[model samples]
Target: MSASAKKQSIYEPDQEGLYFPRPPVFSTVAEERQHRRERLAAVCRIFARYKFEYGFAGHVTVRDPEHPGLFWTNPFGMSMSRVKASDMILVDHVGKVVEGTWAVNQAGFVLHSAIHEENPDIIASCHAHTVNGMAWAALGRPLDPITQTACGFFGHQAVITEEAGAVVVERGAGFAVAKAFGDSKVAIHQNHGLFSVGRHSIDEAAWWFIALERACEIQLKAEATGSPLKLVAPEKAAHSAKHLATPFMGWLHFQPIYDWIIRTDPDLVD
Candidate 1:
């Protein structure tokens, strides 16, 4: 189909600005939890497929709708490839496991809990120790708006070197990380990895992290050639970032990915 024809078929062409149908809106916390769980499980599979899994040294979370003080996360020591919606655990701010049979990772809880607590507007957060993310983060720099995808991070990312390599067992370390993030949705934790926030849903958080990883890979390769990098114009980059790099867009982009995962591995919904 032609581009204009595809747009004509969208549910709300001017409103949503894409070919996707309207997503299922939830009416209750129970419905929201089920939705979040499905997305979280699919996120793990996507992470694993892209080699974002790193010996259980990562986490992603969404605040529990019914229990605001608690959030859901992957089980400690579980392989991202094996994680399922049923295996995710709910944990309180103090790192105590509130539900499920798995234990919580103190560092995961510490880092993510601080962000969730400090930024009430954020709904989800993602973290992982990926190769490109670590390489770019080691330079303690934010992503340059070198490509269209990179612009999603134009002014929406930061670098955090505070307490590098420090285990986040204490709430203080987590708070420091949160403070470093400030108003941005992403942070390059020097010598650690990347962390991205979702203002609305797990889909947004997961997609941003995935895109950030690829963007970092692109930036690293471009820097290695010793050639001066050509970046997008600042004004244009900012404009695109605002319009194309939205929470709803993030959610929309992940729909096909979730569909494919469900088709190949239906157990993720369990």
Candidate 2:
């Protein structure tokens, strides 16, 4: 490849006229909805691969392209590892499973529904009770920009305190979370866990959740050493976040993981 080809943006075609990976464009709403469902199912499998499951205390959702008020999520009681496109349930904002044989998780519906309802621009959301995320949440604080990875969330994350540890089955609790999540990519609920949203795709939401969990783990380990961890400068951290925390970058980062899951667990498309 020529130097100019190497300098070209990854989103552009190479000198050989080979195109880089990009989000698929669908010609119809049905095709987009199906694509979202398949991606959502793959995200659950990816979460399971990271061992993010804890007795069904997790959910990821993608808004339906045809029905904006209804979203698709894994059925209640289904293992994240076993969720497939067909196993996903379509749920309305009122907590009803409008389509699908399986029931929905009330907590998941309450939280995710409120988010989708309140933020119509958000295309996807994810929440899970991962060990590291919960551990860091116990501190009731936002992550410090101590590393390049953590810097992605520098200005784009919030620490939600209202009803933080409460089971989010109540509409009010859900609304509280939605209010706190204003324009942020991720929120840390005090004494609870991580919640991430994506304005582009399920891939973005899922990848951010995974990245936030790792950030939590890193911070927890660093603070556990009782040493003063050096923090990234505010200006540099902001610049890093601008480039690293974009919705497109989040989606791009998950493509390899999505490919691996679909290739190894082909049944997820069923």
Candidate 3:
């Protein structure tokens, strides 16, 4: 064997791309389901790595590929850092745990189920109690596009003021939050935290939530300095948002984070 060949890893991209190559194609729904399970577990670890965990306050869900109406989510009360593919619970629309031993979190059930039920286009949802998101939600206003990161949500984000500072444990409250997501991918639940949805994959949903939180923190920090915030022009912010806010864009951005988690927390896939 050539020296170069020995130096290369066993894996290789099927095709080349400027960003990442096209992900592998799955011939059966079974393969895709496992892929999503791994992705879900990876998302948990990624958020944990970034200190997004707040005593199991965060939850993410992806529609089951085999059963479109059902979804897979991290088990209730599980620490975010310790969530594994084996710990994922498969729940139906009615909040019943059809698979896994762990009970589902009522908050995850109420909030995620409503969004997944209302939006057929949305296949995944992410919600978390990030400090910055909660801080911004306290303001009870939409995010101003003061930076490129914030612009990623210029026209695709909204604020939910109904259940301010309250946990949404009822189906009605959950439905109300879902309604606030009208035509938007991100929602800052007033005095709560953040909620983001992805059309195709939870990768996008998770990445968008992380991005939105960081943007909120940046905005808050920038404002606290007592300096005038230089807001982006509406047209420019819209254009930038259009370019950065797509589901695929978020999924692509998550690839490295996914890989990082896989390396650092290999047990997440157990």
Candidate closest to the true structure, highest TM-score = 2
> lDDT score, residue 74, model 2?
90
Model 2, 1-270: lDDT tens digits are 445543323455445656567788999998999899999999999999999999979998899998888889999999999899989999899878889999888976798888889999999999988999999999999999999889999999999998878888899889988988888999999998999999999999998999999999999999999999999999999999988888888988899999899999999998
TM-scores of the models, in the given order?
0.92, 0.94, 0.91
Off by over 4 Å in 2: 1-16
Candidate 3 structure, TM-score to reference? 0.91
Local accuracy by lDDT, each model:
0.86, 0.90, 0.86
lDDT of 1 by residue, 1-270 (tens): 334553322333454345544457889979999888878888988899889988888888998888888898999999989889999899998988979998988877899999999898888999999999988878887888999899988888989988786777789888998888888888899888899988988888888898999999999999999999998999999987886577777777777888888888898898
Positional deviation of residue 173's Cα in model 1 after best superposition, in angstroms: 1.3
Selected candidate, larger TM-score, 1 vs 3: 1
lDDT of 3 by residue, 1-270 (tens): 333442122233334342433355799999999989989998888888888888868889999998999999999898888889988999998799999999898866898999988887898998888889889989989889998999999999988887778877898888888887898989988888899999978888988998999999999999999999999999999998877887767877788888778888898877
Determine which window of 10 residues in candidate 1 has minimal summed lDDT: 7-16
Ranking 1 against 2 by TM-score, winner: 2
